[model samples]
Target chain A: MAIPAGITGAAWLLRTVIDARDLTTEVAMVYLAGVLLVASRRSWGPAVAAVLASVATYNFFFVPPFYTFHVADPKFLITFGVMLAVGLTVSTLAVRLQRQADSARERERRTAALFAMTREFAVETSADEVARTLAAHARTLLDCEAQVLMQGPNGDLHPCPSGAPAVDDNELPAAQWAFHYHKPAGHGTPTLPGSSHLWLPLLGARGPLGVLGVQLSARGASLAPSQRELLETYVAQAGLALERVVLAEESARATVAAETERTRSALLSAISHDVRTPLASISGAAATLLEDRASVDESTRRELLQTIWDESESLARLVADLLDLTRLETGTLVARKEPCPMEEIIASAMERMERRLAGRQVRTDLPDEVVVAPVDPVLMEQVLGELLENAVRYSPDTSPIDVVLRREGDLVALQVEDRGPGIAPGEEEAIFDRFYRGAGSAGARGTGLGLTVCRAIVHAHAGRISASNRAAGGAVFRVEIPADAGPGTDRLSPAGAAL
Target chain B: MSPHRPASEHPPGVLVVEDDRRLRATLKAALAAHGFAVTDAASGEEALALAKERAHDVVVLDLALPGIDGIEVARRLRAWSTVPILVLSARGQEQSKVQLLDAGADDYLTKPFGTNELVARLRALLRRAGRGDADPTAAMLIIGPLHIDRAERRVHLDGEEVRLTPTEYDLLAALAKNAGRTVTHRRLLAEVWKDRSEEHAGRLRVYMTYLRRKLERAGRPRLLTTQAGVGYRLNAE
Candidate 1:
């Protein structure tokens, strides 16, 4: 490499002084070159050294009429003073510019790291997920093996295991101390300076989220001042992300708990009202009959007994449905799968509901071929009974109720159709909701849980149930259950299917 | 309606604690017809007062009283009297029923119970009170041709032992205890399904049918006669 312009000028001045030619010009030129070198180097100490070297060389080689260490003229002393001042001033300006450049680069790197970490945190849906992502990002940014130790229930440290090496007791203590104090500890820190890990606490808005332990590689002598600041920013962001996930989980749990409580309370009130009315009537009727056994005729006694029996039957159904609903909501309803003949279920439901549907005409269209499906007999009967009851209540007495059972593919479908006022538009879905009766369908004696229970039972059996207005008028409810003849069919007992 | 029929001549003095005015009146009238000296109370406080004023043989206490809950009323009544208390609760909460029974009620009857069952429960309670600590096994009850050995848990008709399901046996036993009186649907449900609420009348009916088939003779169901709107009556006479 060719000598720099400033160094070459210094050499030229030295030769001129050795020749004892133009001493004053030589000293001045050498001083200017020394100042230029100091400006380029941009250090105070180097600039001072250059000034002293130029003066010593000038005094020894060019200050005098011959090569000597003495200055002969006082005017040359003024030149030395000016050289020192100029070198110091230029070095100061250069050093300030270098410091500013370093600061800008540090800020840019920190900003970029923060943006990247925040984006990753934002996409994370769970606290453990965020912890893993934060630990990974921190490890890359800090250039160390980062481990996040969270505070467990009993004041113990729980380190997230996401490909991070285990931290020893001593190193963990340092991390725990930082977490407790919400500050940094160990190596390069005043607290436990000999510790190998740089422990930083993740301070959140509420409090400390956890401790972040970073074990540096041999290459990392000490974290730069700027790097320490960046580490703090990273911990803060990770803490915030963890806090958000914790809040989201807690809110979701609370919402579910509140919903369950509401359902329980409403069920209690409805059950109370329904149960009490029937009991009162039955009790009153029995007491009257007992007191007037002699005065009352046989016919009157029979009528009262019939009312009690019927009312009691209704009350029993309400209770069963309530229990079924509770089981459904709790996700505890177990379907007892058996190869039950559709005919038997239909016959039983019809026989049970014969008294209720006394005035209504019922039409049946069962194929000669026996259709079988894997279902709970009791539940299926309940589902069919509800459908039949709905038909009896909604359909006019003159119109006949149609129950059609057919097989399609590996599934069996049962559709109950009635000819009355068809379900209105937009009400098809609403009718299936618990406690929802269609508009203009007043005086319908129902607990409103019949369809809901039916749907829950159908769904539990892995079947699909839906309602739609029939083309011939009135409403049609269709239920399709998978056939049981296929492989992997497991038959469950009735006791196991109580729910 | 007949004042000449002395209160002491009645079967028993019953205190009916119900909040609904119409329901209370109907209960009082119905219970009166059964030859019970029925006293009506609208609130828990009134029930307590009425219970205290007289030596009631039986108390029909509603759980949903105005002043205090039926369970609380039962608890308070049990503190002083050994009267057979039948709790009437609208809520079919199993825990509440257990609590009430634990609080010293002899039996718990949910609301919407038929009069026959109510009377049957009352009769059972009265019969039980008359025989304190008596051996249930020693007493053999006969309903028409069907004979029940309470101690052995055996049933026989015309000297032939009959097999019955556990549920059927329980139903028959309940009916036999209240023989000659009506057993309402609600009481049957509560007795049969201890944890179940009054809404399980269908289950009770199914069991009743089973018991009738096993106990009743062919062509005649004289012992287990359906009281229609009331309840089943096990006629001893």
Candidate 2:
């Protein structure tokens, strides 16, 4: 490795050429090195050292007329001035570009981290699952041993296990304090500056979802301020995702509870009214026969049997009503709507209620013109029957019950009016509620689902039914169904209409 | 056989089936005093078994029982039998009457029924059963002094035609058919009301009272007799 004399002179000449280069060029190169050092490692002191050494080397080797500290040419003054200017300019440009690159890289990293966190949160079905996923992600992304501590109602941070050292109560308190304040604490933060763990609040719009406690290793102390900010962003995104999951779960539970309540109410009403009708009749008949056998002579005995028969028929009607209500409420009742004569439906209902309305005087006000409506025949008959029955039960025995049919533009209105005590004030709304009965109408035997059933039927037909006090001292129930074109324009005989 | 006018005459027998021992016993003794041959069974199984052994003109059955509920009993008895089955059940559970009838029970009576009402139902059922297979032209059919003309749907007492409503006439016709047998409440209702509800059995009592008042006008009421808790029976002899 010994050098020869001829090779030594060549080395010296090369050094001379290097020294003779423009001072500004030499300074520019040195400043460029400083900028690169700062961009890669972010060491302020090293960058400053590079700047000083580059300055000193420029003045000593490239500023003078030889290897001396003096300028032999005055023109060299402009060289020194330009060298300083160029050095500062290059340094500023280099620093600005490095900072821009670092910021862009940080944003990309945070965005990817946020996406990953959101994906994890979306797949989690339970609070515990969210907690575990959050903790695991925080540990990996934060590049430190991390723990997710959810604050319990009792103000305790329940640490989720990441298989790392558990965050102590004091550390958790610090984390909770940060969460409560929705700010970061410990380590580089203004609060608890010397602490080892970085306590970041998982802040969301509602509040902090939890706290993320990152325990940095010895090597992790070199994490820059920007790195902490990036970590905080990840924590905030995770918090928002967790909040969304919690809200969704609460709403789902509420929906299920509401559905269950509705089903239970329906079952109770059906069993109480529909199932018991037939049983009541059978019991009544047996009791009468057993009690009065001797007094009831042969002819009289026959009469008692007639009563039993009538009651049995009533039972069948109740069962049918129950089935219809169930089908309607469950959305299974399909209306096979067709253009049918309204008078036919009215006649059918009256015929069915003949025995029930035997004692009461029935007055009809039907126009000679045939009225028609688009409706399901079976359901329409049932609706009319219920309305008539309701009137019979409430109205005075001797009072006249009126059934009026009239056409209102685009709608056919069928009104059944009873002279019974009008529905109490404020009860009009409640009357339609399933199983709701009037206050003074006690001892009235009905399933109380009649009006509700009627409403459902009408709603299915896209029509309306309402009850109100009549202008003339009685309650009037009006059902307005959509008009339709149909045959049967020839009015039937009055006797045929009377049932 | 002709329709017999309502007169002061007693029915023959009635059948009662109830699970409660006290209720059944009380009904039987009461019915026997009313001139009915009161038959009783404590359970649906016992009732079915007894009914199979002998033909009862009328049967009063309770819906609730220890084994094979009353509805099932009605179904089984209806298979080969047209005997009137009257059902008894507690109040507030009136819906079972339809199921019982659909299962072949004729009629129903709610609990706490009056003794007078029970007798009237039995008589109606017995009268209807006795008229079985008889042509409408049968003449001069008599229950004591009461004479019925089937063709005219008329009844006569002491050689005078008695005025009667359509319901009253139908009632008399049912009793004349089952002259000797005890008829339960259910049979009478099934025949008269047809598709009418059993809950309106109270109306039956009102009608029977009207019939009795007309029949007892001569102060020698021999036709209608109350059979306490069981039912009414038309006397054959």
Candidate 3:
């Protein structure tokens, strides 16, 4: 009303200023212009109102006998009819144009939202992560609470273990139904309409992978048609991402299975050969002592008894080594890492091997300042012990063995060096493989699993262990692990008392 | 509970708790041959019942038992008795070894152990326990070439006075008090540092290193030895 009134009032002033006699058509043209301007900016209702106001103001002010609705000439009625017809046509076209612009904006918003969802899904590595990302997007876009429940191995619907809340108990049946049937159901659908949340199936290329449950806010009891479409697109992308994650996991499991199959056979052979050798010696010695009790002299009896003891000890060590290898390979041996001094680990390993090391010349070269590393004390000590045992088994007893601990860069390196026949050329890495005994150590008593176990422990600590022949005439095994602190007392305070 | 034989004439009693019957019988035979009046139990419940019936000189408890696991038994037993407990555990049970030791177990021996090792540990515990529960602070501790006069707060190595910082001295004294026995890391920490958290383990090792350097002479055997994942021992040989 105001738009038409203001435009016509300005036109009347213009006509009076020109003071022209035959400008009636010009005045009618002015009224038509007012109607078109109003219709372009507003909907049909406001545009129609602007047309009526323009006609009344044009006739009463500008036509002959202008002060009244009564017309002086019958020809003025045709002018009124033409003006009304043009106003209706312009308002209808303007209404259609306004709707097109509004729909274009809505489509752009939906496209941008879908693109954002797909971009986030591309980086998700697991189904749970995908589900979580999808749920967060749904909550923001749909203004509702959203959760995704995936199909389990047993064909049951289980909520993805993400930040999304678990599906309500009453709503789980609807979610399961949608997943089972691969169809949308629940609150806004025909099936299970009493449910508080709407359950939509995430349909992949093969079939449905999961169900997405959305609980609309109070004001959003019914989603607009376009929002419903966007929700469907979100579920579809989530399904594809979930399938990719599942396939990747399956392939990884297959690779691990094949690796386990290989090691299983190696383990069997190690048990049959290494374990039986000790058992044969232990049983033979015991039988000899038992059968010749009276005939055996004091010295002979002592020798046979000593053989039994030695073989039994070796058998115990083999069994222990095998058990450790199994635990490490199966991922059951969890390393409990802590900040530990390297000297302590070395000292502990030496103490544990004291009986075997008693007659050997073992020299330790420790840094003047202490080196501390984040390591599992027990497991790291085991690594050192295995290296020492290797040195004792391969090297001559009279030769000196050196244990050195040094700090290099961010790593702490512990090297066990021996003054004996070095590793055979090109056989250093092979020795760490399961049951790969050294060629020169023909008569050495070992399970052949010691170096393998050491490598596994080092890997568990995110470190590396390797064996190399020294230039001087010996083999050296070096282990490098991440250090928590360098050789200094700055980071650590005196523990017990003020020193 | 009364003993059939007089305390002075009877052999030192040992209660062996093992779930496996074969191992239990073997433990009984091994302890008997070593001159211990051995009583065996197949579970923690039976061990607790047997302990109440007779005053054993020592207890050998397996950590993996069917009923009332060894740690719980140790806790319940320590509530009333100060009897020495020697835990028998497997190789991978190092984490629990700290808990058992902290729960009042005197010491532990990993499984598949030699009878000689078991007898030695039991004897050391009996020796330490028999010296009475009171502090052995007034006496002189002579372990290998190192001599510690606890009353005088002084140490002499090969008749030469060895200088040690207060923390190093306190750590050495703690180990010396349990000479010839493996005192756990938790026990040593509590005794010297007044803290029992395993976090102080590295600090204890540093002090041990300092003490070892001070007391050790060239060409001589190291008197202080590490028990690997467990703790430390001062060899008195």
Candidate 4:
């Protein structure tokens, strides 16, 4: 008001002091300056007041009614009207430009904030990381603190471990209810209006995934409509990120389940073939011995009898392997631990395998002192027997098999080496699979259960087993069982002991 | 092998029940040659009928029967008579062993058991049952010209010496001891080594080749014979 008023008074004084009665049209410039000053300094309303004052003052002092309240010339009236129109036009345009600049600035700020949030969301690691990102952004944009609560496995809202505070116990039910119902609750909402925190559900295509609890500043207990809208948008993005995390987890689980099924089916088919092959020979031998007793020569009868015996022995071993797999699957593999000397276990296995390895050279490399460890003797014997059998089966009759036992970094390492063709490239790990045949051995008699059984027994003993191709033209199978450790690795079954 | 089950006073009646038809027939014939009056049955029901209708010294039942398991048969037979139940199961599963033993089976034989072991186990079961008139005890085994004397642990073929390696002698003795029955490869290996091995059953083939060459004179029927995948056997019956 003062700016418009002062500019109008200055123009009136200048017109009076200049003593130029003929400078009537030029005097319009002084009046125009007053209108422009008010438009720039103030709003359009005050500038309009200046416009009306300039028009009236020009009529009273500079118009044809210079001395009287009458227009001496009608042309002077046109001048007064044009001057008034120009003032009004200038003031309106100034205000319109001011509003346009302010709006552009607001839009630019919003776009930049949204872009920052989107970039953060792109590479978010976990549901919790998404929560922190959204929460921090919310605090900045809304000018208030916010807590993000995601639904856990139980469908209850749990705050992320780091960023958000736990939803107060008393208010937890309300937050969960809001997330479940996909509705807002607490302060400013129709429900729970007196509560200090506002809970807004993060709804998605998969229903509500979580909730956002915003803590308003002391300026007011509620957020203005625009701020509330901004909060809703932030929560919506957070919900999307959380949904992505869960979907990724679900897909990974499904893939694992599918892979396990494939492995199980492969193992079953391989076992079935092995079982039938032995059964055919055994049953056929018994039938022939019964039917051809009178006709067949003594030597033929003897041959038939031997067929049944050998097949039955291998069949027994196969059945034992099946039982072992079952026990591992059922988590009932109970090991009876005792201090067993490796030398003793090796000797027992070797002695048992005497008839099988009579002509072959079995070289042994062992440490001098007793390498005693807590293990089930029978199970370890089975492991050694399987490894020795595997070596003999895959390798030629001429090549010697090597068995070495030593201490390796907190473990007792046993390496079984054979000079046969080294494991097929990339098959070092695959050979441990239950159904993985020895592809390297052409027509070798391998059911593939030997190595699988070895791995299982070693793993149950809290050990690691690996197969590697030695540069010396053979494959080395190594088993490292943790030596003399705490009781944590032992699997104790109450029922097994009682039985 | 001489008839261990003597028919001195009255031959003891024995029931043979097995799912495999050929195995059952072979067992019946073998038991008959050993001087026991063997009655054969293909199933548990038929065996139960023979048990009720006829007097038998012992029942040899296979655990894996077509209709009912040997455990159920053992339990049902125990309810009526004091007959000894000898269970022959292919699985040799320890759990089944425990159950069958609890269900009144007097003795259990794992599959591919030697004929000698089967006869010995059954005889021991029968003796305990007090049906001791026909005892099963062999002093010597004679297959054609092949002679095996258990007392001396010696083998004689074709009136000449049939020398054997220490392991070969033990192996031949094990096969001749259970002349007409099956001996598992692992059991035969253990017999040779004096201990069991889960490793190579293939090693037995080398010794078998040697025994076959030594025992088979130019033309006379081969004494020691190969049973393909099974252990060697001397066909005395």
Candidate 5:
């Protein structure tokens, strides 16, 4: 109201200046200019009011008996009629142009929002994450509660957990209807218009993937037509994101399945070959002794019995390796750690491997000071046992095998060095793979799982194990376990009479 | 190995509790061949019943029995009798094996063991039980070349006196009491520290290392041996 009145007062002042020359037509043009200015700058209501005010002021001040509501001549009334016509036309056109600009700005905003949502969805690896992003945007943009109900594996709609607010049980039917028919339903929609929320299907290229429900009525406000279009675009983008996530997940599962199939076949063949060889020897020896005890000579019978014992021992070791590998692969073997003296663990492993290490020059270099480390003693012993077994199996009996233990800063280092051919270059890491037998170790009586089990056990201790060529001409397997100071770790001086 | 019987009119009685039929028969036959009058039971319940019916010199129990588990059986047996229990445990059952030994079991032999090892462990348990009592007040204890004069609290390795700290002496004495047998960590901790908490294990290990260093002699074999996950053992070579 103030803007129209201000424009009318300015037009009156302009008419006062032009009335000296009696340019009545020019005076009317001044009032027309003020009305046009008001129409172009303000809304239609104010602009129309400005037109009526301009005409009244023109008649009372410029057209006749000056300052009265009377016109001197009837021709000036035509001027008033043309002025009103032009003012109304410009006001209508200006309002249409303003509406067009406002809608354009709204469209740009929604487009940017869609771009941001798409970028967010690109990083989302799962359908649940995409739903969460969508719902969060809806809560801020639409100013209402939102939920994205996705179809589960069994084709039933379920809201993504932790992504949206709790959905009303009564509204599920409307949501389901939208999902099935790929149309809008509930309060602001034609179908199920009695429900409190607006449900629209998230359509994909294939079909409706899910339903997006927005509680506009619960917030006591309905979305404008443009806002509704924005919501539909959001739903479409989310649908594509969900489809991408599902496809990626399916492909990943296929890759794992294929890999598992390959491993299964490899394991089966390795087990059959390794297990049958020992079984053959044991059964063959036993059957011979049982069938011909009297015919067999004393020494020959002893030899057969010894073969049975040795082969069964190897068989037992094979079974143990298999069990350990299975436990490690299945993530069932948790390292039960405690502070243990490294020397004690080494001694125990050596004692366990005494028979195999008999007459072999086994040299050990241990620190004078007691080095304590947090480790599962039993598992550590197994790791050392495997390393030692590998050394003795590969190295010559005359060559010395060195076992060195050191405390390097915060880590406990144990290296088993053997005077044998070092690990074949380029196979350092491959040697730790399951069923990986070295080229030189083909006929060696081992299940090929020893190093794999060793790696797994060391990993459980949060330690690392590696094999490399020793500078002095052999292979050295090094294991380093973190020796964080824990309970009962009292640093004492080296014993005076330490060996 | 042959059936070398002890110098007695009656052979030592043995109760073998194992669930697998084949393994039970193998154990029965093997123990019988080693001059043990074997009494076999297929489950822990039958083993308990058999124990009540007769006085077995030693009980050989399988850890994974079907009815009553080995630890429970050992606990129930210790509630009444003093029969030595030798548990036959699998490889990866170290924690349960420790629990079994703590529950009144004397020794354990891991599965896939040689018959000679089984006989040796059984013999050790039988000999320890036959000592009549722990005799904590005994004046002297001798194991191999090492001797402990309990009255004087002095230790000698190879006939030469070796100096030891008080805690070291206690740790050795605890292992010496059950020399040639595997003692669980809990038992040793309770005996030496008088507190069986696990935190004391590190201290026990450190002291054992010190004792080993002190007991080392030129041209002499290793005597104080670590039993891996178990506690120390004084080898009676």
Candidate 6:
């Protein structure tokens, strides 16, 4: 203010020291310089004030009237007009140059902020971390509170596992709608314009990954188009970063799955050698005693005979199960179809385990009319044998075990019921998994392959099998096979099908 | 007990090829005590060399060998002689049984067999071979109008020739051999498709239905009878 005032006053004082006619143009040039200086340094208001003041000074001190309001020479009015025009033009040009410089500086600042945000997002490891970075950067860059949200498996948006500048519960619906529609919602947008925060969807190549919510105040309302563009760029970068984190986690999980498969195969081969060799020795030693009984005493001979018979029975079961399990793991086990009656195979299975069942009550509930089923007799027998063995081992000696056979519309179901403590809740399906032993049978000796092998055998036959607690005490193991038997995939019961 | 009864010998010679050391010794001792002479070999190569040197009435070979598997040994043996090769394999390996049989093995017995089972299978082999002497597949198996000639590997229904798949033929042949008796479902599948998985039984049922449809003559098909809820039998009309 002082510089423009002092320059205009000195230019007027110069008129008294020189010939007014010869100094008029020089005085006019001085007033123009003062206006230009004020305009470059200050904003348009102060610069415009300097322009009007310079024109008034020229009319009063340099016009023909000199120090008076009236002008005698009419041509002096032209001089006055020329001086006013130059002062306004010079100030206007200076103000425009100042605006261009300020805009250039703003561009550099925005670029630096974006570069920093990119570096921050690149180092994030998980989706939560990515969201935190996005929210923090958004709050700083957009001058508002920001929140990030991710979608759950059921298609509902969840606030980032954890982050700050968080979206409140009330804002969740707006964010969700934005995510579902893959567009911006809430304040300023056509959708939900009354919302306090604007929600922008973070869309990736596949689909919308999440949403970003931001709240602005009065200062934010006047943002220029360029400032809004900078905010949009930040949001776009945030979307890409969020996807990068999610994809990385998914790939890591896949890699772990593949590693687990490799480990499982290696363990199976190891089990093959460990199981068969020991079984060979135990059964072989027992066989030697049976074959050479003539050299031994009567008491010793009887024991040897029992030993051979029992060991061979167990050994046969173990060897067969081990081979079958190994083949199943490799996807090499295939079902061979044939016609057979269900009654005889189940009876034979019971007969093999008769000694153990001698003390227990046994009953057979079979149809009066013979039911013929097309099945692999060997495989079905094995499945029934495993189930019966399990019943004998788990049930009390006084409890009765019933073998029930029934026919459904397009399938036949065979069930073995034992009057023992029923299957544990929630563990009914897990018992069929390889190497799973029931909690109640901890002390009972087994390789944990019996029930697992049964399931594989049943599945190969295009049938279904399950274990459940019977309505009247104990557990029931059921198997359902198709009547026509052409690769049928019917379930044994509706309950098993739901599972 | 007589020395000069004109019998071949009091003890039969058996070649036992096994990989496990303890099992091989036990098998040899048990077979020897059962009035049979047994030779032990630890590997397929050793067994091959022993077979080339001396003749044995029967050979028991294990499937899991270090260098050459039992199937290769069976194949190599077929190039020279027809000594009944009895395979020793783990249970539920019916595919291996099929491969061995296709490679010229005569029969198979899963591991952990008692002395009685071993002796029974050997005696069955010897008895069947002695009955024919030169031809094992001699008498034709007849069931109703279906004539199964084992020697020619041909089947005829109602006196008209019938073209059958390998599995179908095997199923019919097994049923015809046990014409008056029931053949267990497991045994039939093991003999025909040589599959031991459970699904094979379901498939077996489908094939049984197919067999009945194919055998229908003038819309009157002879039923393949079943009994005891576990086996199949053919009723000749």
- Give candidate 1's chain B TM-score: 0.55
Pairwise lDDT winner, candidates 2 and 6: 6
All models, RMSD in angstroms: 15.0, 18.9, 5.5, 17.3, 6.0, 17.3
Which parts of model 5 are misplaced by more than 4 Å?
A8-33, A50-89, A152-187, A190-211, A215-220, A330-351, A354-381, A398-415, A455-466, A478-499, B1-10, B132-237
Better of 4 and 5 by DockQ: 5
Residue runs of model 2 more than 4 Å from their true location after superposition:
A1-359, A364-397, A404-414, A424-426, A434-465, A479-499, B1-11, B20-37, B63-66, B69-72, B78-82, B87-105, B108-121, B133-237
Compute the lDDT of residue B188 as modeled in candidate 4.
79
Which ranges of candidate 1 are over 4 A from the true structure? Answer: A1-88, A115-126, A129-133, A152-176, A179-198, A204-206, A217-219, A237-263, A281-313, A331-434, A440-445, A450-499, B1-237
Candidate 6 lDDT score relative to the true structure: 0.73
lDDT of 4: 0.72
Q: Give one digit per residue, the lDDT tens place, for model 4 in B1-237.
A: 114445586787889999798998889888888778888888888888888898788899998888877889899899988787888875325456656765767667767666777888776666546632212366676656877776776788767767776667777877766554445555676776645652433345445555655676443544554432223446543
TM-score values for chain B across all models: 0.55, 0.53, 0.86, 0.53, 0.90, 0.61
Give the alpha-carbon lDDT of every model. Answer: 0.74, 0.67, 0.83, 0.72, 0.84, 0.73
- lDDT string for model 5 (A1-499, tens) is 5654665566566656554647678778777887788788778988888888888877877776878988878898899999999999999999999989998998889889989999999999998888889888887788888888989889999988645567889999999999999889998778889888888888777888788888888786668778877888898898888888888998999999999899989989988998898899989999999997799999989999999998898888889988988897788877878778898888889888988898887888999988888888899999999999999999888788999999999899999999988888899999998888887686777778899999999998889999999988899999999988554463322332231
Q: Number of the top candidate by lDDT?
A: 5
How badly does each model clash, as a count of residue pairs? 28, 89, 0, 7, 0, 15
- Tens digits of per-residue lDDT, candidate 6, B1-237, equal 123221355567789999999988988988888777899899999999999999877898999888999999999988997777888887666567667766767667767667777877776555534432322265687666878888777888778888876667778877776553345666787777675654445456545644654675333533475332345656543
lDDT of 1 by residue, B1-237 (tens): 123334466667788888998988888888888889788888989888888888888888877666698888988888988888888764324446656765767666666667887988787777656654233455687666878887788899888999987778888888777665456666776776673554444445445555655665434534665532235657654
Off by over 4 Å in 4: A1-172, A186-189, A192-205, A210-238, A264-269, A326-363, A368-381, A396-400, A419-430, A456-464, A469-474, A481-484, A487-499, B1-237
Give the C-alpha lDDT of model 1. 0.74
**Model 5 chain A: ten consecutive residues of lowest lDDT:** A490-499
The reply for model 6, stretches above 4 Å from the true place, is A1-381, A392-412, A418-445, A456-464, A469-474, A480-499, B1-9, B133-237
What tens-digit string does per-residue lDDT give for candidate 2 at A205-226? 7887788777764344566666
Question: Ten consecutive residues with minimal summed lDDT in candidate 1 chain A?
Answer: A488-497
